[model samples]
Target chain A: MTTMKDIAKVLGLNESTVSRALNNHPYVRPETREKVMEAARRMNYRPNTLARSLATSRSYVVGLVISNIANLFFAEVTKGIEEVADAHGYSVILCDTGRNPAKELKYLDLLARRQVDGIIFMSGRLPAHVVAAIKQQSCPVVTISRDGTRHGIPTVRINNRAEAAKATRYLINLGHRRIGFISGQLDDAESGLPRLEGYRAALEESGIEFDPAIVQEGDFRMESGMRACARIMQAAPRPTAIFAANDEMAIGAMKTLSQLGFKVPADVAVIGFDDTAFATVVTPPLTTIAQPLRMLGTSAMEMLLKLMAGQRLAEIETVLECQLVVRASCGGTGL
Target chain B: MTTMKDIAKVLGLNESTVSRALNNHPYVRPETREKVMEAARRMNYRPNTLARSLATSRSYVVGLVISNIANLFFAEVTKGIEEVADAHGYSVILCDTGRNPAKELKYLDLLARRQVDGIIFMSGRLPAHVVAAIKQQSCPVVTISRDGTRHGIPTVRINNRAEAAKATRYLINLGHRRIGFISGQLDDAESGLPRLEGYRAALEESGIEFDPAIVQEGDFRMESGMRACARIMQAAPRPTAIFAANDEMAIGAMKTLSQLGFKVPADVAVIGFDDTAFATVVTPPLTTIAQPLRMLGTSAMEMLLKLMAGQRLAEIETVLECQLVVRASCGGTGL
Candidate 1:
């Protein structure tokens, strides 16, 4: 391993000069810095990251806590985060809790132990006590797609209630009065409650009577969505339109509808949220609310970076707007 | 901050006993350990990870080097890795290179400096010199979905050649004599060569003459697949079937085929590799070779753990089999 001393000796400069140049300290002369860099590159001198981290208390690494990576929506968000993290010379350590609170706690402990510079919590809702513990540890945390204001933590999220309402209102405008909703698991702490509220709010505004019988819960899985759609199909005066909380469920509902000889946007119109990659690939395409997944990810990372730098954020809750993409499923021209 | 001495004094036990109890060391008496744990819990004694790591020279964290997390196939593999790592009380530090070799090298250095117990390289075709450098660092490394034979490193992957050949043979059995191939980026060090070889081998065995004009290159992306399909369609006497290296490309090809008024299976049979989540959701569903994604992830982590333990593994390469999942696109029952 080549050290700073070796580079200094090779460049006929003091070790401190070489160190300053490597750190890009402004005091180092440009010409001398170039010579030092050339010598360091030639020697393949790699800095001692551990020693530097101990001295500076910055790991140049961020921790990302996610519920599951298999979900396309989260996957897209992760990509966005990765792009920004890389641009800032920060590596991301991902912890997937499988939506288990206990597992989430375990990962929190692990990240704390590693002394990561900052953390971005996505999808899974952390327990209040755990959040308190994280704050006590003095770790910078930015939550995404989950409310963090009560905990005094910064957050990035899409307006789930408004997006859901927009999708519902779109269906209502399409001359469909009897609309049904397929929700993610009601137990889901972050998304379930707000999305269902949005659906109800839209119905109330449209002067349409809300029917509890028309609502079904899914586990935010395609198979669960399929089963949930089956339950909705069995209800009397079946809805002429259905809105799924996310695209996966919407695709599943479409499959069930197609099997039952229902033509999308002809016999029924369907709308989904999150507009995952499959939303455009599915038959008849899908009219869905786009969540700006990549932007959500990148913004969360940037916010966490700011928090780590001891900077006051402009907003505690950064609410990104959602766009409704109309496609054939909602009786719109194909993209 | 409650130290071992404080806990020991409170529990009327030696500091070593308290440490052993907290670490769940087998030598501690069961009843005494239980008492110590109860006291420690009451005291809110959180173990100092940095101190523990310095004492043990092991942090219980593994490094995961992946080319990209946005790809569904890699995401599934990551989920599998996470399951095993979490179960074993290990956390994964993810390093995504986005297929950039320079970024991969930077991550390897960072992980080494962080003193990760081991590393799992997934889909990152690291250069020989870089792999050699990692080996010299004496950290255990296990490669997934790529061969690490040159560097004498442990690897876990599916038999790509055989799987591709099987997919092509299936198409031939479906009475498609003129088959087209959509190869993933030829520049990729992994998958490209083996898959192309498999395609050629299948054609030779079926006594069908291979046509260079029928093969198109894709970047394993949906848009790339669509473009490649369009080029293949423009070829004289278009192929009756197309085999894509992965599901995303296959779906893209299907989209283009549908737009051209070609009915899947009846007009052009399509097969894809890697049965991702969206494989079944697409309109003609995809027939794909299913890699044991979860198993691959789990095995890589296990191998890395063993390596970290200084165990000598005789077989460096672990090859898992791939299954052909027939779906509507290939004239089979939909999944």
Candidate 2:
């Protein structure tokens, strides 16, 4: 195994000089660094990163705990996080919890043991135990798409309430007096309740009565959306439009409407949230809320990097905006 | 910083015993391990895994270099890899290359520096420089979905040629004469050329003239599939059935057919490879070849694990089976 010492000997440079150049220290001259790197490559010198990290107390690795990777939303966000981490000479260790608390705890413990410099956490909901565990680990953490400020953690997210209301208002503008809403799981306070509340708020603002009978709860899954839409459509004077808290459910609702022999945007219009990859591919190209998914990831990672550097955060909560993307499902030009 | 020695002293146990308990050494009694764990939790002892790894010359970490995570196929495979790695007390460091050779080489170097136990590599095409770099790194490697046996590396893959021929034959059995084929990038010999050859072989077997005019090359992306489909459809004699090398391109072709006002099977039947999530969500859910994506990840990881353990492989290449999933796009019952 070739080492920095061997590279130094080959380059005829001092060991300390070779070490600084290998570590990319700014104090080293560019030409010196290049020569050292060339020698290291030629000698097949492999640096002992673990040892160096231990001595410096910095691993240059970050832990990313994502709820699920199969979900396109999280996948795209991960891409953004990876891009930023790579650009900054950092490696990311991804732990996909698959919404399992036990696995989440296990990964958190493992990451702490590995001594990752910081962590970026994304979950549908932050449980109390998990929050306590994170605090106990003493690792800098930045939450994405969830408001972690209440727990004294920095967060990057969009205003779910405002965006949900915007989507609702768009439906009301389409003259949908009897609009049905499929909400996310009630336990998801960061996204579900706010979205449902936004729907009610929109109805109130438009002088339309909020009928609890027309709303159903979905678990933020496509099948749940399908079931909720079926139930919502069974109400007397069925809804003229359906607004789902997420795109998966919206697409599900569209599928149900088709099965029920109703034409989209003619007999019933649908609007979804999250504008994921599924948004454009689904039939009629779903009208949805487009969140800057990648931006959310980059922002959270950036915040975590700053926190890891011991920099005081200027803001605890960084909220991005969400836009309503008009498409054929909502009887829009879909341009 | 609660050290193992401190925990051992407080628990009235030998430091070696405490270390063995914390490390899950097989020789340690279960009760002793439990007692040490309880004390470690009470004392908030975070183990320095880096130091232990260095002493043992083992990191208990593996590198997974995937082409893309946003591709549902790879994401599902990653889930499988993570599940198995987590179960075996191993950590996976995912490097999504996005098909860039420069990034691929950089990640390989980083993984080598990090001293990962092994690597599970997935790529559309493994270039010569990359193969040479892996050879130089002296790291155990197992490839997924690509044959690396020629380069003295173990591989886990499906028979792309056989599966592609099966899909073509299925279309032929459905009474299609003028069939169009969309291939992956020409340089991807493992997946693209074989599939194209399979299509050609099927045509020859069925006594149908293989017309080059109706075949087009796609980059295994949705937009490229659309472009290929448009070009294929413009052939003097429009094809009655179109087969894509992958699902994304297939869905793209579906969208193109819809835009051209052609009903799925009634006008031009469509078949795709890799029954990804999009296969089910698209309008007229796609008929595709199910490649056991998750199984691919698990198998590759298992092979890499065996190699890392210095175990001899019984087979150089592991080939899994592929099944033709008939769905609405192929005008089948879709059950």
Candidate 3:
């Protein structure tokens, strides 16, 4: 139970002086600070961070609301956030909501009640209630993957519509006329709906008719993708290529295609978004839309830090670019 | 801004009575508690959890020390930990060390100083300094994937050695000689070294001579596995089969095989440890030893909870089982 008082007594210094020295206050002499630190270490003094935080209103902790950590896309983003948080001497309280709005909101209120200095909202979609709560809370918030620009909240996200269109155009360029699309929650305004629109736009530009029967809904899960494949396989004039909203579904579609006696790129082709770790591991190294996830996480965290420091954001919606990674899955040469 | 006192004054009751009702104390009538909750919600009262925690010397927070969250195995384990912690109304402070010893130790010290109710050590290996720190800290520590039996620490882990031997024997039973083994750090007593021993044991039991040249090191990463695959290919006698320590490495090796113009199962049959998500995504889906990662995480958290509740562990080491998932990579029917 050694305390600042004990260090002060050991060094024959005033209690206030010891506290100032330990806190690295400018008023304390450097020599006095070193002496106090040495004494504190020798005594094995553990500071009461709770009390210190109460006094300074700085907990050195932040909240990170992530959609799903099991997904490699979010997992890599979390890694990036952690790297930055750790470097800044801050700990993160990760709340994985599994895409449940209720769970996400519950965590939001809980984090605010726990007095986190700031929060990083890393969910894919921004619901109205959550935006309202964020606006009401005194703490700063930075959104990742969703545009929170209209609400005056800073956001870091990639151009989903543009990237999705690029992916579709790439498939069209590869001589894919009858292409099927596996979408993730077509109702999702931020990502799914936009991606579907991109596919339709590409088809329109290529003078190819968009067939609703060939498009299936997948929840961005492998099983859903497999199920979607079944639907697409039964459609008239079966598609020669399939584009999934994400890599998991694409991999799942590949698995189903193989099970149904179809060889990838030989009989059919496939493409995926979010070039996650699974992209490279899959048989043909999937062609995908690569978003700089680590950068996304890093930038979001940095934005929150700046906001927490009482600085106004310079950018409202920080949009990052996505790259089209050509791989064997899309009949691209390994070379 | 609404306090219990305000509710008490408005209801013509004592503040203590209102507080007891809101807390759902046993002495408070159910009707009164319900009324108080309604009033609190109507008034939008937010509880000051910080003050209550300070008074009770409890933060309702636990520390989860994980090696790497980007690894799907760890991510699933984290999901399990979060599920259990949330059920108990506790938040997890995730400290992903990325297998860095210094970072791990720093987080350990930080968690201790932050006064986390308990800690779950989820690293592949527990260093001596960490063990020493765990012993010295007041907070209870539960370890996952390591044998903490000797140090009086409760542990939840699968039988790595037995599982490894089983996988090796399965390969041997398939009439494979000149088998290659890709391992994590051989010096890692917790997982790598034991798995290596298991491989040797299986080889000796099968009357197959153990050759050092066939074994290579992989740091549980895809790139490391790829590099090891290259080295194994250059061995005096190339291996007919390979067993990578984990699925990421196995997938990497598979990619290397394909790039080198070798087909899996046809040229070199392969198996992997930890049937991660990548196992099923890969072409010729990998056959692997599936560790109950979520159960391991759940059990570890439960063990720490018991220890925190002043209960002594009846068993120090809680060993879980591993299952053999046969897939296309090992030339096994999808059955």
- Tell me, by lDDT, which candidate is best: 2
Looking at candidate 2, what is the lDDT of residue A141? 87
Question: What 10-residue stretch in candidate 3 chain A is worst by lDDT?
Answer: A326-335
DockQ of each: 0.50, 0.71, 0.61
TM-score of chain B of 1: 0.93
Task: Write one digit per residue (lDDT tens) for candidate 3, span A218-299.
Answer: 9999999999998998998999999999999999999899899998988889999998888988887889999898899888
lDDT of 1 by residue, A1-335 (tens): 67788988887889989989988999989999999888887887777655566567677778888988977778889999988887887877888877888767777777776678888887466677768756766578888987687678888888888888988888887778898899987876568877888999999998999998889998777777778887898888989988999888888888888888899889878889898888987877899999899999999988988888899998898999999999889885433
Error at A29, model 3, angstroms: 4.7
> How do the candidates score on chain B by TM-score?
0.93, 0.92, 0.93
Provide candidate 2's TM-score on chain A: 0.93
Clashes of each: 0, 0, 0
Q: How well does candidate 1 reproduce the true complex, by DockQ? A: 0.50
* Candidate 2 structure quality by residue, lDDT tens digits, B156-187: 99999999999999999998999999999878
On a 0 to 100 scale, what is the lDDT of residue A298 in model 2? 87
At residue A223, what lDDT does model 2 achieve?
Answer: 88
Ranking by TM-score: 2, 3, 1
Candidate 1 CAPRI level: medium
Superposed by TM-score, candidate 3 places the C-alpha of residue A134 at a distance from the truth, in angstroms, of: 3.5
lDDT (Cα, 0-100) at A36 in candidate 1: 88
Select the stronger candidate by lDDT from 1 and 2.
2
